[model samples]
Target: MRNLQHYTDDAFEFHKEVLKSKNTTKKDPSYKERIENMDDAIEGQFSAYNDNFVRNTLENIDSYGHTDDEKNDLLKLYSYKNSVIKNLKVKITTTAANRIINTCPNCTISEINSFDHYLPKDEFPEFVVNPQNLFPSCTICNGYKNYIWIEGGKRVFLNLYLDSLPAEQYLFVNLAITGDVITTTFYLQNNGDINNDIFEIIETHYNKLHLLERFSANINEVITSLENTIISFVGKLPLDEIKDSIIEKSNRDRIAFGHNYWKSILEIELANCVEYMNRFVTID
Candidate 1:
């Protein structure tokens, strides 16, 4: 997984814009007054989130604005997602989003199409419109990670804004080739490079998001594409040279993506597989 820069928009101002809009008041008559009354507490919660994120104590922060809400009227704040007033809907795609607009940070495979609440809005309604709490993600990853943040006193997923993703290799794949068919199984190992606690969180991120299974399912087409690319080089180069070229391609991919990028790692593994290389070796 990749880390992302936090949203830098003025969240409080945006919240005010939403609250002041006639559309918002028309939809939920009581929400404007209720939220205005709790403005201090809401701002405090924002401060708490920033402090907790910096201190790595997010799990310790208590849910605000939910202490007395029996009917959950505060949840209407989530309608900011549909707000067209003052072009607030565009706020979902922050400047940070442009960096990975097509690719998902959570999966690195799928196209990003939605924003996911890092802390579920249902449980932390105070952050429904909090820009810091939203992350751009694909629909599948968002669905897989729905409403799961902390469990057993540990954060269940890596915070893109807070966690520093290691550039060293952590994701690995074992490939099996039988005749013309190739199959792959992907898994993660720390390689003793990352902190144990952080690695555990990464493990949970993968498991909870079903990343490995998803990667495996999507890799066959990639493998076929790689094979086709490699075939083009068979008549022009020696087997050893072709493998070196593959290794070079992987190095470039690692630079473009990351050390553990599934495709880059897969290319490295493929380059090292003697049996696989023999396919090109005999062609020449």
Candidate 2:
């Protein structure tokens, strides 16, 4: 998983713009009171957020006599025609490369299709538009995560903008050969430099997202793609040369995509196996 830069927009100014735009729409009986409550919530959210703040805000919403329907209406402000939301989408989509497949830094297997409220908007309406609370994610990870990060008084997921991921390699793939077919088993290996809390967070993230199973499901495609490439090299190069070429490609992928990228790890491990090389060499 990778980290992203926090959005630089002034949070209060962003909230104000949404409110200003909403003022022009047809008003309801409780529109004025709803606007005032939203304004107060935005103002109160200027400080750092924590579990206590979330708990207090949820209680305050009830005390203010806001109905579920009223809160849902207020949540629409997050998607209102605002420059802040537009800019956030652009920044997230183009952050690390020309195109981001999945904007959720924790899982890279799928394409990004939605924004996940790091804290579910239903439960923490105050942060519905808080830039830090919005994470770009694939529909799958978003559904899997679904407001379940905090459990038993511990944060279970890694905050893409806040948590410091270990620089050393932790995710690894084990390669196994059965006759002509190859299979991969992905697992996490601890790096002693990383603290236990962060390690646990990664473990929880991997399990919650079902990353190992997801990656395994697609391993056949990866093997087929690699086999196609290796076949091209069969006659063009010697056995050792072909082996070196695959390893070089693997290293290049590792440099570009990170050590844990499925293809990178797969290629590196596949290159080292004598049976894999022999099988490729025997291909006509």
Q: How many clashes (backbone N, Cα, C below 3 Å) per candidate?
A: 0, 0
Model 2 residue 15 CA deviation (Å) reads 3.0
Candidate 1 per-residue lDDT over residues 1-284, each given as its tens digit? 55666756667766666667534446556767777887887788888887887786789988864764722655665542455321432443344425323578788899776778888888888877777777777899999998889998889998887888888788999999999887889999987879998889989999999989988888877777878888998888777887888889888877666567888788789889998878776664
TM-score of 1: 0.86
lDDT of 2 by residue, 148-261 (tens): 867666777777767777767778888878886677889988968778887998899898989988877778878887778888989888988877888898777666555566
Alpha-carbon deviation at 181 in model 1, angstroms: 1.4
Residue 104's lDDT within candidate 2 is 50
RMSD of each: 3.2, 4.4
Candidate of highest TM-score: 1
